[model samples]
Target: MRPARTTVATAVAAVAALTAVTGCADKTDAASGGKGGPAVHVTAKDDSCAVSTASFAAGHVQLAVENQGSRVTEVELLFPDGRIATERENLGPGTRATVTAEVKAGTYNIACIPGMKGQGIRKKVTVTGGTAERRDPAKDAAVDAYRAYAQAQADATLPKVKTFTDAVRAGDIPAARKAFAPSRVGWERTEPVAESFGDIDPKTDTRADGLEDGQKWTGWHALEKQLWQDKKLSADSKALADQLDKDLADWQQRVGRAEITPTSMANGAKELLDEVATNKITGEEDRYSHTDLSDFQANVDGAQKAYELLKPVARKNDPALSAELDKQFAAIDTLLAKYHDSHSSDGFVAYTKVAPAQRKQLSDGVNALAEPLSKLAAAVVK
Candidate 1:
């Protein structure tokens, strides 16, 4: 997802203002903090993802990945097909995170993501015997849903980024500007799963404000500065464009190769809204360009997709909740349908165009969905 330099054409900033009023930004601080299961400690370094053992029995397991490296890192447990049995990501230096999972008797690998970016370090492992473990249908279905969701987003968004970058490289300012928001829809829609790649998300779409000191800003927003703000094209733009092209290609190849689960999908869906609740709504994300609406809509779309995938599980677990979620999503749909964006190819209005009252209406709608969506992972996993 790339940003262009410019003002908010679609007045979606109102959505952000309401989000701030509603205190949604704090959602990013939420953590799973796994409890109970035997904690498997995995230490991540620049060169290696150090783990105590390579064997896990078929059952519930809690894995903690510690970022011992100077740069941020993440650890993932992958089965043979690159499916994530469990993962803990974005652990800053010296910070530790955990992944609680139930694994069957199968071989697994450890993917050590370094620098909070890049194709991480990989290692092998063996999962030994346990009780005759059976896969829960709902959980199994959710895994499939997440896998399809990840792959679909990658496939849809990858080519779009290339086209956008090509316009940037060729100095087609107007074309790239128009391509910016729509192209990001794919990435935004896949936020929860796509972000698991450690470095790629930051590289593709990290905002300048989110960057720590000394962090080299490169990616979509890097090009966004030149494209919309300066309204001029140069080597700087082309270079960032080229780098973005490479990073996107890498991401396209890497995503969807990992296993998906219901819990993560539900969790990811909620997190997507949290992003909207905090950044998109508050305009912290679309700082340079005011196209927050496109991203905002895409996030809701992605979250909706996750919910759709898990609908069966939800219905089986709690019909009332499932019905309520449907109505909640429908309400947002009706609300957003009325939004008219000026810059976006779609007709949604400028982020700033929507009134605070209307923005609050949408915010409340999302928060409502979040309540039921939040319970999805646990309800289905159970």
Candidate 2:
């Protein structure tokens, strides 16, 4: 089934912000690090994907991919030389596979397709010096920090999702619409990827009527039409609403009642990270109009709050994990600072500074962090 779009959107935005600060790094200077063999680890889910490093060395590369989403996911590895080193298809949820390929270094892209065209995750990795380094403590800490930030963010906003879903279930369209912005703020940073839906205008789309016109509706406009414009609602609309409520309820129950163990926190982090990564790579826009970078900034703020609440428990359970979590927070701070500087008050103002190709490069650069961040979350909980 299609997962909750609003939650995914908020998560994507938060992820993007986090990536902007902590995940985005230049790895062209390969000689600075110690000599090591080349290896890459990747994780894939219905909503996202992750990679081990943004840069790597050329040679024999081993890519480990894991699917964490509820639906089937696929991952493909591409080389700058225009070659597909490996393609893993139909990797069901909670399953993983490894692929070995001879990579010639330079740069590469990893694409994960969870749904629709352009509705997939893509990341760029650099292969420098012909070798890769094993996991470093600092790198590990950064990953943990990112995971902790994501988990905290999700925890804070999940209640808002429940509220929205409840209003929808009660047929309170106005309430549901009102609740949309607060809930969607969590994933607003990754608007570029979230807006890629062909049938929807991520800027002003919505999904008011469930399964109507067979048009694959999306965004706030679609939602507005469904709630205020559409004169018709299929029998499935009620059912969909019911399902939506149930999904939100389930999420609330799981998140609220579930023990705040490392595993659970890690799982939550994984989900958020996946959403973020997917949006970064896929550029699927949200269905809500207000779901923008500012909204995402709010989500990041919420995540910070959540992290504070869970900090003690996270540290008590794993000190190393806690330290890592701090790194992610720092990274996020850096990213937001940079993003704010680049965008000014408007969204993506830096877009005008770069060539079209460079803009694409920026997008690609953002995608590279998806898998690594997700894996870092997994490591914390695992």
Candidate 3:
């Protein structure tokens, strides 16, 4: 790999296999439903699920999610294998939205994606008297594609992390800083799957500012603080770097076992865009190192990879959406490329170098891509 400063920082693993999630087409809802079921009204507070009822008769049920919190939020019906029966995204405060879905006689969860980020909060809901279709992992080409994509990301991540950690352990602060943002690219792209694993996500990705009172801040942000803010590394910093490498290696083993599906690929793509809108484009994340642009490019690349894998399925299921996504992804890619590094064709300019107007252009591009991506989950879950 090129030296950190010379690397273009695109997650190279994506393009090679992004096309693998092709041809698992026929996903249909063949489940039997009882008489039309009742509407279940749900209230999403900042951190709570105030459900009108936790039990319902299994049939065509209506789910209404009202966002009572300050930040934007969404609601999803969690099915096994990462399938979402129905979901509503980006509902603002005091707003309500609903989705009609065929539900079966089984226990399900009302997943509240508060602030439209993180793992989301889940509330259990049960239904009775009808049957639900079970998803076969074996038949899901998209899931296979997703698992492979994750493995690629992990494999890509370890070496980058090792480079960064080695720099830190060697007390080479400048070299470590140069390597930091690029190293985080793969993991950030695979976040939809990575964050699902217990504890590891928080341990590795949590923002120093977002840490709970008692939480020991680790991961990229912790290291970012030391490298960019403190501007030096000590023995404890070396240990932190080593721990990050170890954690990523351990997490790579869990990548293959991750739940990947057409629905997951679609949702993960949308969520990665959310990360861009929520943080990266704002220049908030890499405040210390000014590496936000690299991360921004990485996030976009990650989302595009997922979109690429699901494109064939989406085209079969919903051609209009597929076309729109195609256009949006292409436009965003072009806009981002304007910031490409002169020295490294694959790398981009420093985040600090981006002008305010160009930043808006990038943000607008991301928002445009996000709108189409938001519709992807519903379109590909055929």
Candidate 4:
């Protein structure tokens, strides 16, 4: 799910005002330290976003985020136009997570969203003092390849979504039911990219609970409820189906233009694992249809695909991390395979049937993988 965003005009105006503050443009203090560069420390509380320093030297910067808030919070490093450079979400109260993002010498924001909704509390930051990086040719190749992969995933999703939507338009409950989980596989695989487009994800994937005050509930989950829980099509079903197709088509066309870098790929992989743990494993994502396992597997597949692409760099930089990641990923895969269902169209038993103990195991496996996966961004950019 997409978190609430800062508006472009608001962000731009804030950035402009912050640009005039000489203190924000000053060099980072030595007390703000990290291994290879200054790591910006962010303390996200219920009402404020606090940063250790307003500026840092350009390169790979680590954000060590701690949520001191009562509500679950998220911290993001956003570009001036509100595109995510890198972000860590679903951070429960008092929990800590690290996000590493590649930043050039420029202005950016450190946004803390308490409750993971509404216009977030924003702080302007200056990424100061660095010349253009002479990036490794191999890393450039990885970015290109990942871009192709994202585009391919979008291409594959369109027709599958069409099948589902077509079934919806025709009032074929059984066909829509069968097509629902299958249609979402490709989207789940590259969700971070789709999410980067901002408006598209909310329209196509937001859950009933994730909606804003005035936002309409559409997308796969909304349709899923109609087909499974309500057991009949509503008058709005066809219009909603058409809207899904159009929103997705917009994603397919715009995905090629998404801002993808090696660090973003590595970070996106970690985000996928988080998606599984926070949403899919809890069975909240597919509560109506009980197809959470299908999403579970797809998220793992996406994360693995990213790891595979970045493996050469990560292996070279930190071979031990590479080894640990490989072992943990296999563990997750093995655990998930226990739920495979040959009879199901999506190849997994209904998530509703998973026992509490079994769900805890899945959650544990995801956390194990997440720790190492979180290190991937820092490793790749090194």
Candidate 5:
């Protein structure tokens, strides 16, 4: 007979994996603020979970869990003494739930079901004394602003994606390229948020997949390579674009079904930022060699997922900020087009060979975008 899917043994092992990585910088710092606390925020994803800050004292605390993925999942906060302080069950995608628990300052484990077993994604938050800092009204406003922008950006890009995918399917390179520009813009406006994690060299990093080994056929590099390097269209490219379109549609549907709350969007953004940092800091390019690209793809995937969840709330909450985000998203599209047209395969080869010092400058430029983007996001929640 097949093994039981949710057996105690399986759950124990999964919980253990979460415990190992729980103390890593990702979730803990987010919840504890790297200090003692009362207000804690936790973000949950497919294979892992993260807290907004770290190190808290034992007391009454409000713990918020933001579900950024599509599927329903649970997040459980386990104490060192083998007690469950809090457990949130069946949290729908793009939604959030909160629990106020009396937690002692110590180590704790946070885990997701199925995928991240034995990976040690748990976090340790120390609770000491004093009430948690009151939420900043200004920062809260900024968060709301950026959330609006991000949602508008997503909405604007949908039509462009449809056109681009259709053009690719029709074997119209120029048209497809034109369509691709807008999608790239969506990414660019958000690039600052993407950059905060650090530098990512698509060429040298084996983790970048399709760009590194020449097998995978999706994402920015994949589409860019087809337009320039291969100079030939294939059925797979169209198929991949179609998949993206479907994903976007699903995201739209989910957004419509849920209520967009400030807590949910803020929690989602915090989680995405941590995921990006985790991928940039700890991901090994060579580990993904057998597959295609680095976990950078996963990193971006999470950001996109979080945006989808926050988009509706943003649009409903702040229309003007949403418009501004759309404009920036469009600007990003133009930049990618210029970069792709100039670089090609030959350009990528040469660009990748630049001195490390020069590369650092480029990396700095890319990563620096995160600050402004983060500011924008923070503006939304404010």
Candidate 6:
């Protein structure tokens, strides 16, 4: 099973609106009026979630998050509707990080998830004053372009998934296997956007072991296992196929409604590279089919699309970073092409055929790209 790319950011944002409990203490401090934007300090302990300030002037804000708890924690800035304004996860005890986001005047939540699980400790926050956004045309263009790309990926995925599911329903193992990797290309490319919708990624993409207790195994990987690992299709397999189709359709319909911003696009691009480094490069994502390279390429494709759209602003703000990103991206692309297979189901050699040394090279390339990619959010916001 894949090392559960279970994005808690995706899950909490999805559930917060419907089930979020009301009324926690608001920790307020004097809003920062100096350079580098307002600073909101967040402390996450096993038993309590605390913030230095809960109310502040709206605009660009830096959430300085610290985990004082034994367990690793996640902290999020959420809109009233449960959309993520920004979030940081895997904060081990005594560690700290800063999350930057653009927020408008509205009500919001600062949620701290100890152990990076559940709805988290919630505190209501109020944003006073009007938009403090920089009126940059390049920033607006970047957001618009990335949103359109994300929507297009979602639209393309539904039909491909439908074809894969159709083969599953027919119990045609060979045909289903052929369709599997191609079907996932779009989803892998725009995963962070799809994941933003709550529970959708879990429903459609979770591996067997990735499931929570009592959660049914469904969607692409569930069927992949049935086809390649189990080598038999039961009535349950057909039923799973139908459910997968429905979930993907829901994703397509809702992707257009996702809240996108320049910083989110930049952050999301880095998230895709992280997906490759931790999961795809390990060949854990497509364990049964051994088609990990397809997913790897798709993740790169998505990350590159976001980076390209944000490039004008990013290049202007940090040309050196932009040049390095270009070099690393091209290096990875060249490395992947060595595994290309024109006649294969996913247009790449099976992951099982990728030698250990080759996999290490791939891993190194992703890490190389990811370092500079992480700076994208801050660069574009400038």
**For this target, which candidate reaches the highest TM-score against the unseen true structure?**
4
Q: What TM-score should be assigned to candidate 2?
A: 0.38
Kindly report which residue stretches of model 1 are placed more than 4 angstroms away from their true locations once superposed: 1-132, 341-343
Write down the lDDT that model 6 would get. Answer: 0.77
- Give me the displacement of residue 34 in model 3, in angstroms: 14
Candidate with better lDDT, 5 vs 6: 6
Candidate 4's displacement at residue 72, Å, is 0.7
lDDT of each: 0.68, 0.45, 0.67, 0.82, 0.44, 0.77
Which ten contiguous residues of candidate 5 have the minimum total lDDT? Answer: 284-293
Ten-residue stretch with the least lDDT total in model 3: 17-26
Residue-level lDDT for 54 in candidate 1:
76
Give the TM-score of each candidate. 0.70, 0.38, 0.77, 0.90, 0.40, 0.86
Each candidate's clash count: 25, 39, 3, 0, 55, 0
- The digit string of per-residue lDDT tens for model 3 on 209-233 reads 5555577767777888888888776
Q: Write the per-residue lDDT of candidate 2 for residues 164-197, one digit (tens) a residue.
A: 6566667777676666656555334212112222
Q: Candidate 2: list runs displaced more than 4 Å.
A: 1-179, 185-260, 280-283, 287-290, 298-328, 334-382
Better of 4 and 6 by lDDT: 4
How would you encode candidate 1's per-residue C-alpha lDDT over 1-382 as one tens digit per residue? Answer: 2122123432235333323332322233223322233456678888888877777666656565667787545577776766556565445456654445666677888888775344478878787776654567766876776787677887888788878888998889888987777778878888666666545776778877545457778887777777777778766788888888788778778775654566667767766766776567655576666777778888889989989888998899889889998998898788788776464664566677777787677777777776666566556654
Candidate 4 global TM-score: 0.90
Q: Report the candidate with higher TM-score, 5 versus 6.
A: 6
Off by over 4 Å in 4: 2-35
- For model 5, residues 1-382, the per-residue Cα lDDT tens digits are 0001134444343233222222222132234221234357777777667787676555445566776865445565665653445544434455454544444456766555323222235776665665554554544554566556555655765786688778878889877655554454443333323222112212112123223234343454455557655777766887766766775544433333332234434444434333333232221111221111122233344344455455554555576655554554444334323423243311222233345464334333323322223322323433
- Top-down TM-score ranking: 4, 6, 3, 1, 5, 2
Pairs with backbone N, CA or C atoms under 3 Å apart (clashes), candidate 6: none
